[model samples]
Target: NAVDLGAVLEQFSLVFCRLKFIFGPMALHALDLVDLRSVLHITSPCGRSTYQVTGSSGKTYTCYKSCHYCSCPAFIFSVLRKNDSMLCKHILAVYLSQAMGACQELSVSDQQMCDILLAKDG
Candidate 1:
């Protein structure tokens, strides 16, 4: 006999909803990839290196190789979700791509976060 499973999933959804409500929404950055790249160029500690961010909005945002962080709500969400070191994929990509000039502090921070997660899991 087949059993209906919809109700079981509904309970999980309720739990998730409650978690979200308590957390007051997941942290997420709202900035576009283009603007994030620009900010990285202007604020990157390594000076400047030209790069381009092709946004889903079809507008290309140009900046230096140092661009990181979306400067958007997604950034916070990413952090809350622990999806990435930062909320913006562009920022994570920049860090991953620009190894030579990437921020050591960010690397350390990532390692620490990983360690914390691992410890919690174990």
Candidate 2:
């Protein structure tokens, strides 16, 4: 019996497209899951405002507070799905935003901010 090559090709294409939609972001998200220690709190204009939320397995995450702004691939996906989910970056942003009031001294250094966060964590 002769196989319908054209029909098989069309079905394959459909399957591939669907898979791309499902797997593309997941693959990227896996990449996004990095070590918390890797997320160095570089001094940013936002003011020493960054930290990593590491999972038990050491997968670090950063959440976006806004739709167009996210530190991680998962944030973008959550934003697209219209879910207000908390990620490591988002929590850090919140902590820093609040910290700004407490650490308003002009002389405060970046290290001080880290100290503040560590203190609060304890």
Candidate 3:
């Protein structure tokens, strides 16, 4: 994966610095997801990777590492529309997963990935 942890952490701190204290609780939740190993790193045979996380609600959310996106309502309402924060807790979990090497890697076919991504509900 060649991801430099230091660089990723630096970027996280830099981006999150702009957010307010309201998002503080999400950090703990993100760390919990990482510690619990709820993050999944699914890769296809072609070397493309996709990120997904299981929330406390027992639903899986698709997270995009390439564009820093998550298919979570908090991300859409708070992070994007309201601009309450730069990233969702799930996205934070993704970053923490990368930095801590806490993700469960899975190999799936392109068709499986498509089915997973196109799913309306997890």
Candidate 4:
């Protein structure tokens, strides 16, 4: 059976573009099934504005609320590369946790914690 290369390429391009729009510019096909389940844990030792997200992959990434930045590959390759404001699943999970008040808050110094809170509020 002969494969139609042009047709295949076109289909692939369409799917890629759709995924890019949905999951930012990163080629995160594996993350298509990502959701709150993809996040293993959330910790904020500094404050609410700074989060440490542990994904299902067991890798921890830093997320900043002030700038909506995540140190994950998806964010680095997609959001930062494309200059997009979209957040990755891990960051989204953090937002969800925050909304539900489920994030495990860690202890921080009074000054630093106050600074972070002020920064977030202000």
Best by TM-score: 3
lDDT of 3 by residue, 1-122 (tens): 34798888888787656432546888878878888899999988877778889998988999976887888888889988998788998998998789878899999998788876763558
The CA lDDT at 31 in model 4 is 44
Tell me the deviation in Å of residue 72 in model 3: 0.9
Q: Relative to the unseen true structure, what is the C-alpha lDDT of residue 17 in candidate 1, on a scale of 0 to 100?
A: 71
**Model 4 over residues 36-94: C-alpha lDDT tens digits?**
34433323454344666666567766666667776677777767788654767667666
| Candidate 4 segments whose C-alpha is farther than 4 A from its true place | 1-49, 83-85, 109-122
lDDT tens per residue, model 1, 1-122: 12457777788588657634543333112123323442222222333233334444544333234334343344457654666543354454344335434322222243343343231211
- The TM-score-based order of candidates, best leading, equals 3, 4, 1, 2
Residue 12, model 3: lDDT of: 71
Superposed on all Cα atoms, the candidates' RMSDs to the truth, in angstroms, are 15.4, 16.2, 6.6, 10.7
Q: For model 3, what is the alpha-carbon lDDT of residue 3?
A: 73
- Model 1 Cα shift for residue 102 (angstroms): 13
Return model 2's CA RMSD, one decimal.
16.2
Evaluate residue 15 in candidate 1 and report its C-alpha lDDT on the 0 to 100 scale.
Answer: 62
Query: lDDT values of the candidates?
Result: 0.39, 0.42, 0.83, 0.58
Better of 2 and 3 by lDDT: 3
Q: Model 2: residues >4 Å from true position, as ranges? A: 1-40, 44-50, 62-68, 83-122
Give the lDDT ranking, best first.
3, 4, 2, 1
